[model samples]
Target chain A: MDENPGLSEQYRTASPWPFFIALSIPLAEAGILFNLFAVAVGGLLLFFGCCAGMLQEAGYVDRPWRSLVVGAVIVLAFGGLLLYADTQVANEAVQLAERGYAVLVAGIILFVGGLLGEVFVDDGEFAV
Target chain B: MQLNGQLALTILMGLFLVGVFAWLTRVENWSGYTPLSSGGSAVSGESGYVSEEKPAGIVRWLTTVDHKDIGLMYGAYGVFAFVVGGLMVILMRTELATPETVLVQPGFYNSLLTSHGITMLFLFGTPIIAAFSNYFIPLIIGADDMAFPRINAIAFWLLPPAALLIWAGFFPIPNLIPAQTAWTMYTPLSAGVGQGNQMNAGVDLMMLGLHLSGVSATMGAINFIATIFTERGEEVTWANLDIFSWTILTQSGLILFAFPLLGSALLMLIADRNLGTTFFAVGEGGGAMLWQHLFWFFGHPEVYILVLPPMGLVSYILPRFAGRRLFGFKFVVYSTLAIGVLSFGVWAHHMFSTGMDPRLRASFMAVSMAIAIPSAVKTFNWITTMWNGNIRLTAPMLYCIGFVSNFIIGGVTGVFLASIPVDLVLHDTYYVVGHFHYIVMGAITFAGMAGIYYWFPLVTGRMYQRSLAKWHFWLWMVGTNITFLAMILLGYGGMPRRYATYLPQFASLHQIATLGAYMLLLGGIIWVWNMVQSYFEGPVVEDGDPWDLEASGLRTVEWDWFDRKLQTKIADGGEEEPVTDGGVVEDESADELDTDE
Candidate 1:
């Protein structure tokens, strides 16, 4: 296991990406109502995947890795859905549809990422 | 805000008067000194009580510093508070028993529920444990007295007024308002708006009183830390310190950090309430989230403070009855420290739904999950201690077993709440109530009972009636489980806590819980009767290792010192010749050997 300093620094480095995604997507989707929800969902999925990766790297958990994989997949899926939703909104027949698709995609990715990250981490050495 | 300014000034004046009076008395040497005594009678010779003896009246209790006297005062006061809090629960249960309100107005019922939660946690649970620790830690550590006896007296004195302030809302004070804010005192709700806003003088008083309680607790923590660090006998080394003392040391350390934060938080709230500060005022540059941050910072550790000593007591006594050394003493000690540190980081899990940054939420979830590791380690050590040993199902052991079972359920449910999504659903619901009570009521209270039973003979020199003790233990175990389990189910079904009346769907569960509460009350009454009767009428038992069949023959310093002291007193004609089962003479000779060494 890494010493406290190393582990803490590593944890710090790994933590910021999730916040970045959460913050950046809203700005990126500004004035583009069709795919806004999808962009938000994709950002959320990326955040969960980062958490899983950090937990694993810190040696704080042992788990199935399914959550991490799922989180990654969700990020990708939500990005695609957001793109599709943006097109739908531009078509103007279903402006709200884009945001709904984004939200659904984001939720799935983050959920899967969290689960996989927890499952794959090696937490035994730090067991109390 | 106008009313709060006046109340705050009044409290400040009262505190200043107390400080001045104490200082003046000390300067003039007009202070009456009361000596520590076994009971009401004064101890003769060098250890004569230091407290001033006055007319055997109300003032005697107010100024007494004798640890035993203070302990009894705490015990009686805690029981009274517990009964009051329990009655509130009973009222809440009755209101929820049907869809309609019965005994009180909705506002009044909310007050009852709020007071009940705060009173149970702060007044009843913590004080009862403090009572035992105050009385026994010195005795068990082989110290003649606490390191700071006068401060100890002051700590006990602080409780009554604080309690009165919290409950004072029940009475009609011409200008005072009972605080309608929940016990957590969430911001904006607690910070009154300028004129035309609803306000209560009672709320301000409660906040001031809470600040006093925090001060008193911090003082007690300092005393405990000093006593363990400096007051241990010359012969006692760190490793040789009894388990109970070790627990006190760690718990005290936690308090040293935890209580001051509470003090500061209360002060900030006071400023906001009275000085027009914007620390917690929503918008206008203050955030409601700040209160959650500050409150939980101290609040989570507060739970550990409540549970740690009881855990220590259980660790101390369980091995004696098991007829073996503790399974992993160092492991238990380390895990305690680990838990104390880990507790600070997990407080944010309580704020999962409060809309903190999601990354912050995830970090909190990870830390919360990590706490389970140390807690699990402690649990494993306990199980290994009891595994395959000569287990005696004594009353104390029964309570210990109950503690383990109840705490496990508490711990498991706590895990469920750690998950962010899960907490989003359960936050502020009855489930949260069930989770805490299981730990506070089940684990801490169970540990308190265990300590009382284990030490009763030593304290009073009399054996409690065994049959009656058994009945009390069984009833309490059943009543505790029944009462809390129903609440857990109700909480899962989305029943909101602190509500006067619930929907009809929750009626059956509420009725069940109320019935269980009656059983709990019955159990408590029986326990009081048992203790009282045993003190006066039970058969006398000579103090020794009363639970005699230990594998290593009671190696702790408390046993060694107590036996040595009892023997010397007999030889010096300070005590009678204790009747030994095997007719062994007192070990006064051991004292001579020690002197020669």
Candidate 2:
């Protein structure tokens, strides 16, 4: 078995423009406005992982179509879960749902940010 | 997918039978072996690693610092303490089973309940986790030994004598019976003179023992933190730290802050008990509330210290079996830190019904509820980690899943208890008991089992009978849910905790719980049998990565460096391998390697 080269090298030269335009904008809107935080966050995470995978496959940063598609699906899921929660529960359960939504949004933002950061920033410079 | 009691029971019994059969078959077989020289590749390898030479005398067992040996010692001591504590609980349950003081005198029963609660929490729960951490953390982190190996030995040595002193009141010593005050040993009640005029010497001794245990724990915590931070091999970077190592770091941080408070509080109590001081005395000079504040401040975070390491272990093992990287590794790590910080603020929630001011109670309630957010994050991360992954139903993974289920119940109930209005009604009731034990025993114990099963091969160099491990999990799951869930119902019926006797209406539930407790005991016995028998006879694992899979793109240093240590130890005649691929590669045997590059 040959030594498995790590993903860091592939991500080093990728462009951040597609990530910022396609995923970050919609995630930020969903997170701040509709409060479908969990979906937003989960989507963002998926997007980051996807982007990393893409970067590894194609040694470049231009994959707007894939990022946009993944980001939209994430937003929809958050919105759907929010609607379901509002219809299904009351009182503390409702509050729990709301909090879940907020966290989801935060998670998405972090994911997108992490991926974008990985692309734009020098890997060796980032301490951990 | 819908599980019912009958099916669950049958599955459990089947697992038990399989486990027994596996154990029987492995009673005389062995395979994997590593040369002694290779053992030093992990960690710094400065200390002597486990040699093929087995020690022949009793002194060898006592003085040994071998990770495996220490692990067994911890396991044995934890089991002993658990049995002692369990028996006390059984007596309390039997008495409560009738809603009357049928089992023993009221005072003696109080002693039993108090001793049982404290002993199990401090002696059993904490030490059992320590047993695993002590045994496996070094190995998994790719270290040859703990940073402070002698201190490791000292830590284990301190436990038995401390435990003996705490429980010494139970034995017929001259004028000493076990302390009647509850495990928390609340001031005034704890300070009160005994009925037999025997002086409060037992309480004093208990405090002293607790102090000793705290010191020992502090030393161990320092060792864990230092070892993980400083001793990781060059290839093992911050991101590449193993889940268990992460857990040990967090747990050690909790201990660093929490145990010291406990030590200081114990010191104050000791002074009050003997020096005629009024540190916790009531009325004009002494402040009873002061003790409550000090104790709970440490007490609450202590819960996390107990639960977090196991949580870390589960996070590590569950993903492996689920065939996925932990969902949101950074998030889980953040949540752990959040829990630790928030744990400090929520201690006052425990004192809500103790006549704290309304404003204070409300603030505590808010803080307590806030802490739930992090806990919720952790739960969500766990589910997501397992979602759509190629989940393996190994014994360790089962236990990890069980931990999630149990912790969910525990965390939800905690939210209810965090409310001031709800707590006023439930304070000192069986509801509180149910809530905590669910978290402590349910979450922590389940996590411990997950870790034990996950790391059994690494620690013992032998594979535990899978059938038996599965059996142990199922029986324990049923027994734990039944026992603790029944307590929740009992609490709803307005049954108060710490009462030797209860109203007749609570009898049926108490009886059921006691029966469940016995099942728990039986499950535990099966586990001990499996572990012990496997130690001598289980199949030896030769593969470097026994789980047969590794997560790609994982960042922790443990995976990068430690895994290679095992490989090199087996493949290259114990010679130090070159540090390759941008990670720590300390090559003590550089002269031996014939490098063509």
Candidate 3:
């Protein structure tokens, strides 16, 4: 953990910026470039997972706990909804996969939101 | 034969783009080089570039976050866009010179229309308002700078690439079906349906460009809103805030609500085009009307977004030129706010013919008619402002007068179209086209031209040739009336718009419109010439208040700064290039305060 970071170092994020950037590109190029959006989503997750270890290393955000907690909560809530829709919800009411996908997207968006929220400012310690 | 040539051209264009990217970024070290970090003069001023050096040459402009510099750039960029858009319209008018195609293919005409519409609205209209807003907002509110400086720079730099992307198909691409869906880019036409070039590659580019514009505008809105809220000087109260800043504040709020939705809609449109989605694709449980709903929602407010700041400009400028106080000042402000509130409500008037519902149409019609009240109030205020005052028939005043006069024609036509029965008859007719152009080119553009002329000395420290400027004003007055008035007549004669060819009966009006267009084109040429010649060769305005209203005590903060800046430039630019080593440029005055202050 560097105490005083340069501009280049300041740009490094605990949030998965690279994953988001890459995922957006491939998704926009869908049908024209490639039909395999699952690949893009998978690659984004993998990239994020690989970079998640960097959260321990001090970057923009010192604590990184709020983003992690918020992300976890979002995933849990939407994940529960998806589980219920798939297993318990009545058939012919809604397409479980589509609902599940939408919920999954919502969960990830919230997760990213929380992730970025941690690093937006240097609020490392809680205010007393 | 065509196939081989197309493939070769494709390869060539691909390589050219690769070369351009490499040259712009890597080869020239353009991106890596810092423009602002040069050890130049940083000035401390009451309401000016406080923390920044006066950057040298191109870097001074490129890296400037100073609201004044940003404003100048916006003004310059907008003028350039206006010329380009004007040229496209000229070509269209040339084509419409006769019943048959006089100059271009039908495809080419469609592309021209598309380019002209987008460029006029997104490129010329918005940025011109920005030109005034960025420059005047802080000056009027007594703020030193915008709330976010870096964000301001970022907002401006987004425009060039957006403009380039929208016009990409004009280059020698392999399958260059330049977007002909018009500026509306209505879906099913723009979506990958019915085959042909309707699913043109250019449509995708235009959509992306539109997306970038939305991004720029939204960022600019955020900056404007933040600045107006937070950056008012201690002396300036909300009650005392100038009309220009007030309108900008309201316009920014509208932009905040309106532009993001437009951006989202554009992204969905892009996806529908290239990503095999059917958000607005017809008959796939998706409807074409969805795009119309999203578009006109932003679209209706977009007209106000273009006109409001200029309306504010007229409110500010007319009084100055007329040598009188603006009558009904509070009422004008109230009306401005009312217009802002009602702008969101009247977007559905554009969709009355879309067959939505009778009740919805009725409500929208009511709101549309209600929206006209504020405009009428402002017009009344303006007329009252000019009534008994010693009106100076200066170039800017003439344009202001032109603005009010032409706005009457444009506004009155708008009320007629606001009625559902009238709109049902005139929908997609040249009447709608006439109404739109009158507001856009007549009211908004006329006011914009007035602002440019009025602020020419203040912005550039030079006054334009008055004789040439008068010619520009008079010609514009005649040309706009003749052209747009003829359009109303063409509509009355049951002529539909967007057609490359028309019936022989409407030919006479189209010819008259074309003749007037040529006059307008000549005036436009004079405008550019005036700006270029005036900036380089025109007499330096030593007296800051070139209008000579010093004794009248017209309270304008921009003139105060303008006076000081001219002193600095004239004083420094005359004898010695000031010592740039210490990172500050000081005028040769003992007192640092502006004379007004």
Candidate 1 achieves a global lDDT of 0.68
Cα interface RMSD of each candidate: 28.2, 26.2, 15.7
Cα lDDT tens digits for candidate 3, B1-597:
966764665465346434533532321221121222221212112111212234344535554556777788888899889888999899999999889876998888999899999999999999989988888887777766677655576577778767877887788889866799989888778776786687777777777777877878988999999999988988888888888888998999899889998988888887666544568877873577899889989999998899899899999999998889899999999998999999999888988898899999999999999999999999999999999998999999999999999999999999999999999999999999999899998899999989999988877656898999999999999999999999999998899989888888888899999999999999988988998998866776667678877766774877776666556555454443443312334342333223322
DockQ of 3: 0.05
Native contacts recovered by candidate 1, as a share?
Answer: 0.00
TM-score, predicted candidate 1 vs. hidden true structure: 0.71
Candidate 2 Cα errors over 4 Å, as ranges: A1-128, B1-56, B66-68, B194-198, B550-597
Model 1, total clashes:
32
lDDT of 1 by residue, B243-339 (tens): 6777778778888898899888887886666545568887874578888898999999888888888888888888887777887899888888888
Q: Listing candidates in order, what is each one's chain A TM-score?
A: 0.40, 0.32, 0.33
DockQ, computed on Cα atoms, for candidate 2:
0.01
Docking class of 2: incorrect
Interface root-mean-square deviation of model 2 in angstroms is: 26.2
Give the lDDT of residue B424 in candidate 2. 87
lDDT of 2 by residue, B1-597 (tens): 434653564365346435533532232111111113322212221112122222234534544555546667788788789878877877776666676677688988878977887788888887898888876676566665676555566577777767876887877888777787787878777776445422456766676667767877897899899889877766677887776678778889989999999999887776565545568877744577999999999999898898888888888878887777999998888888888788888899989978889998898999999999988998999999999988889998899999999999999999999998888888888888888888887888888888778767765556798888888888889988889899999899998887777777888888888877877877888898999998766775555467766544333433444355455555555454442222334332332234211
Best by DockQ: 3
